[model samples]
Target chain A: MFTAFRDHIEKNFPQLLSKPGIVACSGGVDSVVLAHLCTQTGMQISLAHCNFRLRGSDSEEDELFVKKLAEQLDIPQFITHFDTNEYAAAHKLSIQMAARELRYQWFAELMDKEELSWVLTAHHLDDSLETFLINLSRGTGIEGLSGIPPDSNGIIRPLLAFSRAEILQYAREQGIKWREDSSNEETKYLRNKIRHELVPVLKELHPTFLENFRKTQVFLSESAQILSDYTAQLKENLFVPYHQGYKISISSLQELDPLRGYLYELFKEYGFHSWNVMEALLTAMSGKEIHSKTHRLI
Target chain B: MFTAFRDHIEKNFPQLLSKPGIVACSGGVDSVVLAHLCTQTGMQISLAHCNFRLRGSDSEEDELFVKKLAEQLDIPQFITHFDTNEYAAAHKLSIQMAARELRYQWFAELMDKEELSWVLTAHHLDDSLETFLINLSRGTGIEGLSGIPPDSNGIIRPLLAFSRAEILQYAREQGIKWREDSSNEETKYLRNKIRHELVPVLKELHPTFLENFRKTQVFLSESAQILSDYTAQLKENLFVPYHQGYKISISSLQELDPLRGYLYELFKEYGFHSWNVMEALLTAMSGKEIHSKTHRLI
Candidate 1:
């Protein structure tokens, strides 16, 4: 597990260890393992935990466990408690969204306070796969199908290279102890349904479904890059920049292969679902002032 | 009806007089009416029809009816008959897809043969609405939510300015004779399902659903254009064009806002699903070399 963690950091994030960072250690199996690996790798790290106060005693206990673990590892620990349910109600957000917002906000705060260069998390490959499936079920375009990123801004996931099974094996092999969140087992949440039900069925259909899906994402990512380049060229030829928006000469645009994939991408940039909008706009050209809900392209 | 059709042409197809075109006329109310309007307006036009041969005598009757209609109007007529089921079987395409392919192919051919500039169809507002709902049910993104085009390549829909109700009303007022295709009543096809079942339910829920949806498409189209422009600028700064594909500087990309919509559009151009792939990619960057099923991004 330690070797995999170290290798993942080296391979995915070559400069990860060069910067000071805060580890979002929740004392859960995934994060605890990450904390242990960071220490073992001799990286400068601080631990931060957010007690969402969802499970009352369980939440507090989880925070205390992380605090003790931090002491044992000789790392500075920052902890916070929040009325997550109240936040959810006030913001008209789902509990899950509320918790995510709070966690990220708190992590950002901790990073600033400690002057950390990066905020590290322990989202593994399995989590990425789960997210891919969830998004797929929700009627996404190709972009939605691409799955999660390994890094963004100063936020990073150093353990995403390993699967949950691999992480668990590593934790056991290294004699690492961690807490389990009971909520993870509940099927009420969409993610939990995906994790516990949908994925298992999908796995039965294709043993390597998760791995294959991830692979598909990589190909899609590469393809997206090429199409974007083409769109850039097309834009240079057809679009004139304006202060508020742009002026796309209908005649110039008419010269393009209407089926060119990049054209769709270009359309998407203007907040249009390029394909349908282009089709509609192109079709509208034969009619008088075609109006849509918000705008008219005459 | 003729006045509305001429007005539509004047407003939408400002350059229609410069182009000679073929009207895709079946002896149907919509196309027959459209053909009559074009003739009355003295727009150079020829009649084109596809006989899918699905209705035995009825199919032949429709063809004979169109031929007589063209003759009566003193317009040159083009006709093609096809064993649609056989074509579907040979091409391994659904009957609807096969029929569509055949129709468009024949229309294009007639356009070339007659030296016509454009191939005109009778698709109108109601057809556009049905397409939007169908795409939406199939889980389309913004692009899919937009309805059909009025002009694609050299193909144009001069009647798209009016709704189906308007077309029927116009036909009644003009005393136009038309043959109704029995297949339209068959709900086995997805398009038919949308027209017969889904549309009524939707109309009940929102009386102006079709109009509203069309409006939404126009808004999205404008938005898509703006986003494409922004992405082009961003791409100029970050992408290094290579012999085969381009390379994105990780550092430059990292500096952008996480919600940079244009970046997603740019990625989509490369055949990638912009947002999800970027998210997964960014997430993967924090870890060691994560191998998805097919490709590995370090």
Candidate 2:
């Protein structure tokens, strides 16, 4: 597994090891494995852990576990305690969303301050599948259905290549001791519920659900790209940039084959998410005073 | 209304008036109004109606109604009767889908034989809005949610600028008599349900829900265009086209800011939809085979 990990890094992200970076270590099995891989590769790595203080002693213990591991590896460790509950309340965000924003924002800040090249996380394939389902259930377009990215901004997921099972297997083989958060088993989080229940049921219905879904993602991504390319060409023909958004020539738009996907692509630029809105805009192209708080297309 | 219709055509599709066209007159108020509008403008027009024969005698009545109206207007009329049930069974299509395909296919044939430039329909703003909601409910992506286009292929919707209520008002003002399809009132069909129930309920929730939805479509269309444009530029930078799909240079992609919407847009070109799949892909870039039946991106 380690050899596979080494080969993967060398092949896919050869420049990654040359940069100083921070691993978002939670002392969980996945992160521990990731940290171990980084250490084994002799990469310049710093461990960063967020102590959300959600589970009192358990949260602190997790922080301590990561700190101790970093000490044993003789790598510097950075830990931050967050008042997540208060943050969630103040921001009116779900705990998960708030925590995510807080953690990533803090990680980004640390990266900037320390001049770290990237931030690595341990998000894996199963997590990607779960997110795909969640977004699907919530009524997403092709982009939303695509799932999590490999690298966003300066954040990289080195362990994203592995499944939870694979990570656990590797951890066991390496005799790597890690902490498990009981919250993972709690169904209160939509992701956990999806991981524990929905996915298994879906897998039973179609044994290759995950594989097929991942495949579909790849296909849709490609299809989207083709459509995107077409839209780019259309934009050159149809649009002129405006102050807030864009000014589309209604006559030019009318001239284009309606089935050409460019019209829908045009709608997404203004933060509209539904087909009805597009219809309204098409209708309004004639004459109507359609207004929204933030934007108005007509 | 007739003047507005003519003005729209003259402005948007001046070439359309130079050629003969067929109006898909359904004998419903909207289509009746459209037919009258065309005749009033003294444009070369042929009236066409499809009798799906689903409503037995009522279906025949509609055909007769359209024939008499066309005769009254002293215009060429084309009428066809379809055994929709048989067609549905043979083609493995739902009755509604079968009827749509049959009607369009017949229209295309009529256009070709008659040397018609386009097939005109009476799809209005209300219909467009209903389509938008239906797609939204189905969790459609940006493209699907963009609603009905004013012109598709050789089909043009001239009355899309008007609402159903406006169409009825215009018909009444013009003293136009038309047959009503009872199926439209039936809640069994998803479109009817949306038209009668869902839209009203949504309107109640937000007085401008319909308007806002329409605006959202416009916004999303534009946003989708921008993202797609960026994706196209990024694709050229990171991928080389292959026969099957495209080969992505992992290093070039990794060098890009992943949070830039273009990353997801680039992945979407390949067919990934869920955020998780993108995350998984990012992880896979670190060296795991993200496999599907037809393709694998490692």
TM-score of 1: 0.49
Identify the runs in model 2 with alpha carbons over 4 angstroms from their true place: A187-189, A204-212, A229-233, A242-245, A254-264, A267-270, A274-298, B1-298
lDDT of 2 by residue, A73-141 (tens): 999999999999999999999888989999999998999899998888998878877776555444445
Number of the top lDDT candidate: 2
Which portions of model 1 miss their true places by more than 4 Å?
A: A205-209, A228-239, A250-264, A267-298, B1-298
Query: lDDT tens digits, residues A1-298, model 1?
Result: 6776688677767776788788898889999998988989888888989888888788888999999999999998888888999999999999989999998988887778777888888888778766754543343444554456667777888766677888899889888899998677662466775566545544543456555555554544443444455567767877787765566676666555433334456666645555555665577657554344555445
Q: What share of the true interface contacts does each candidate keep?
A: 0.00, 0.01
Please name the candidate that would achieve the greatest TM-score relative to the true structure.
2
TM-score of each: 0.49, 0.52
DockQ-based CAPRI category assigned to the predicted complex of candidate 2: incorrect
